[model samples]
Target: MIDLKALQNNFEAVSQKLKKKKIDAALLELLKEESLQLKEKRNLLEQLQADQNAKSKLFPIYKKEGKDIAELKSQLDQNKEKITAQQEVVRLLEEKLSEIALGVPNIPDDSVPEGSDEEDNIELKKVLDTPVFDFAPKEHWDLDSNQEWIDFERGVKLTKSRFSVLKNDAARLERALVNFMLDFNRSRGFDEVSVPFIANQDSLKGTGQLPKFEDDLFKIEGENLYLIPTAEVPVTNLFRDEILTADELPIKLTSYTACFRKEAGSAGRDTRGMIRQHQFGKVELVALAKPEESDQVFDDMLSCASDLLTALGLPHRLVMLCGGDLGFGAAKTVDIEVWLPGQNRYREISSVSNTRDFQARRAMIRYKDGKKNRLVHTLNGSSLAIGRTLIAVMENYQKRDGTIAIPEVLKKYMQ
Candidate 1:
């Protein structure tokens, strides 16, 4: 959540920053108004409680002097009622404020470029070179004309559209990709972790996926649990509502999990292949660092992901996401797009983001620094999407005889 205290203390500054993310100015104003009202009501409630305590103390003096105490009792009773009413008012205002605050997106960093959408994103640089195929490249789904590797029809029969079953080489490739990515991330100082595929409402909310993107989630029936859209939700939330010592300033972890999404917002996009599947495998990187060192950690994460692609000999490019294209909880984001020979263009295969203290505040993750407790900066990135990487390998390594060659790095894992 955006800091309400910061918003209240410097409304104009926060307001300007949020504007870049296309936030409604009027919403910020409403938040400020509710905060002020809550403060006023709390003050009134405190005064009433103080008055009640002072008046109740007078009872002893009244009894000692043998004076009538009925009027004093009546005044105290009325004051108690007023206090109760004021408390309720304060509670409601606080609830309203919290509702508004949780729905607001994080303020974009000053370095983020101004843009309306992905079209305006700035490309940092390209890696390697796009492969030149002597034969015209075919999309993943069309490469295997007999559909031996990926079974699409059965997937629809078992579940629904946008779900596919990998078979033979494709299945092995997917597993190998996950293993390779995890081992690669571990070598870069990220400890490997195994997290649950299911997450509860609180976990999702802590990662900024709830109260706004519910439609895009696959919730379990008759329960508050939902299938995780990404490992980031469960991995980053491991430290939720916890405090860490300063010595553990940076916590880096990598995890591989099956991810599910409803694709509610993506109606007509990438409907033909596994590019936008309902279920897929992903290897994720999550980190928590002191605020002062988060930027360097962010750069490290970006390079880690980019270098992973380069190791596979896949051509890709790094793009800086503009304010409007940034994720809901990210202050800044850099996306890695991998080249697909069939599509003749680069598609996003990974995104590394630094949320700064945004998720920490929502998750209540803090670290002690000398004599003070402060929110730790949180970051997450996809080392690579398993399905997409397999697709990239297939298209880039396809031969004239309609056969796919495995990359040298993943060959050992495939065996």
Candidate 2:
């Protein structure tokens, strides 16, 4: 949620920033009107209640003086009825305000590079080196089939498309990779966690995955629960509706979860291979920070993710996501694309995003600052999508005999 008070006070500045997201001025203005009306009504109700209390206080004096009490009793009954009606109205108004608040996105940073879509994404720098293969290289699907690792046909028989079975070294390598990534991040001061795979609607909304993006979520029928689309959702929302001391400002968390997605709108793309899947494993990094610390924290997360890929000897590059291509809840995002030797191109293996206070506002996560309370800034990122990284490793580390060499960094974990 946006700071309604700040939006009201800095309407123009906020509006201009939101314009990058293409939110209309009319809607924002309507929110302001609703907020003002609610505040006014509630304030008036308070005044009336105070006045009624004062009138009632006179009743004891009148009764003690033996004065007529019939008229005063009738007036008191009428005041109570009015107060009850006002209380109901306040409830409705508060719900209305809540609906508006939760859907509002964070204001874009002044320094965010503005443009439309991924094409406008600014490339940062390339890391390590792209591998050059001498043989007729095969993509992950071909390699996996050749190695008898991924059995997509049987996976479909069991759970349908967008699912697969990893056998032999592939399955072992995947497990090793997951453990290696978790240990790698935990050593960097990120507290590791194992979170629930399914969350309620409110939790999804808090992470900006509901309302607008419902089509993308795998919802439990006849229930408010939905499977998490990423570890980021569950990890970042851990502090939902919480208030922490300022000393706990830069809270860092990492988690591994199986992500589920309906992918309703993403049909006919990346249908093959693990580039996109209904269920995929991921290691996520989530942080809570003050405004000034958010960007640096974002950089640190990117470095942590980049280091993992670098240590695996995978060539990669980073790019800044443009306005149109930025995630719905992120102020800015950077994607790390790792080189796949067989594909001869860099594919996104991870993404680090800084949402600032966008998520905190929606979740009501705050920190007390002396006598005042302020919303904390929240950030989350896929340190690495396990499926994609596995794909990259298979394609890049394939020996002439179709055997895959596990990355040196992951060998210890395999034991």
Candidate 3:
């Protein structure tokens, strides 16, 4: 959610920022109208409450002074009704306002580069050089199709499209990647956690996944439970509705999970391989830090993701997502796209984002500093999408005869 106070103070400036993200101007207009109504109704309710309190005190004095109490009682009754009605009005206003607020994307940081689309996103530069292939590369499916390593046809038959079965080394490789990432992050002082794959509605709402974007979730039937779209949901929600000690300023956590996505809004893109699967394997990193520490955490997460690609001997690039290309929950985001020789271009394998306090305020995840508690900033990213990394490796490391040469970093884990 946007900082409504800031938006209220600098409405015009924020309006211009929204355009850089290509968001509809109607959102700000809605916010402006709702904010006015909220302020008015809230003020009226508070005044009524104060009046009722004052009346309770004066009523007894009127009776004790031998004064006729009928008018005072009648006045009290009328005020009671007025307070009740105003309270209800305020309640309705809050509901409407919060719904609108939930749909608004996070405000981009000032230093964020401005652009309208992917083509406009700034390239931070390549990480490692592309491998010099001895022969033309083969797509992952072509290399693993009949080898019992990855079964696509069976995946489509069992579960719908965009799902696959990893067998043999492919299956173990996924596990290896998860362990590798967890250990790597642990070395950097992040705690490892196993989060529930299924989260309750409150968890989803806490992370700003409900009310809007519900269509992109796999919700459980006859219940408010939702299959998590990413470990980001559960991991980031670990501190939801709580206030931590200030000493615990930066809460770092890493988790491995199978992510589910409806991909309801993504149509006709990356349909060929595991690049855009409905279900995929991923290692996630999450951090809850103070507002001042957010940018550093974002940079660190991006660096960790880049290191994973370099360690795997894969070619990839770092892209600073333009305002329009940023995620709904992110103030700033960096996408790491690995070079896929078979596809002859780079495809995104991970996105690191600093949501600042947007998700924290929604989740009520805060830290106590002295006597005051304030919302903690949140950050999350896929260390690397394991399934996509496998695709990149298969395509980049394929022999002319269609066999994959495992990367040296994974050789110890392979056998």
Scored by TM-score, the top model is: 1
lDDT-wise, the better of 1 and 3 is 1
**TM-scores for every candidate against the unseen true structure:** 0.96, 0.93, 0.95
Candidate 2 CA-lDDT value: 0.85
Cα TM-score of candidate 1: 0.96
Q: After superposition, how far is residue 5 of candidate 1 from its true place, in Å?
A: 1.6
Model 2 residue 42 CA deviation (Å) reads 2.8
Report lDDT (Cα) of residue 137, candidate 2. 74
- Answer with 1 or 2, whichever has the higher lDDT: 1
Candidates sorted by lDDT, best first: 1, 3, 2
lDDT of 1 by residue, 19-83 (tens): 87999999999999998888888999999999999999999999999999999999999999999
Q: Residues 1-415, candidate 3: write the lDDT tens digits.
A: 7888878889899888777777778878888888988998899899988988998898789888989888888998999999889889999889988888888888888867888789989999898888777777777767766757888888999998998888888888888777777888888777899989999988998888887889999989999899999999999888998999989878888899989999988899878867888898889999999988888888888888898889888899999999878888888888999999888899999999999999998999999888999889999988989899888888888888877788887877777
Candidates' lDDT values, in order?
0.93, 0.85, 0.87
Q: CA shift at 151, candidate 3, in angstroms?
A: 0.6
Badly placed stretches (over 4 Å) of model 2 are 56-67, 84-92
Show the colliding residue pairs in model 2. 1-362
Candidate 1 runs further than 4 Å off? 53-73
Report residue 73 deviation for candidate 1 (angstroms): 4.2
Candidate 1 — what's its lDDT? 0.93
- What is the per-residue lDDT of model 2 for residues 1-415, given as tens digits with 9 covering 90 to 100? 6778877788888888888777778989988888888999899789879989998999899999999999989998998899999988988999988787667776767666788777888899999977767787789888766548777777788998888888877789889888988899998889999999999987888888878788898889998899999987778788888888989879999998999987888789888877888888898999999888888899889999999999888889999877777777888889999998877888888988888887887888888888788888888888799989999898989887777888899888887
lDDT of 3 at 383: 92
- Give the TM-score (vs. native) of candidate 2: 0.93
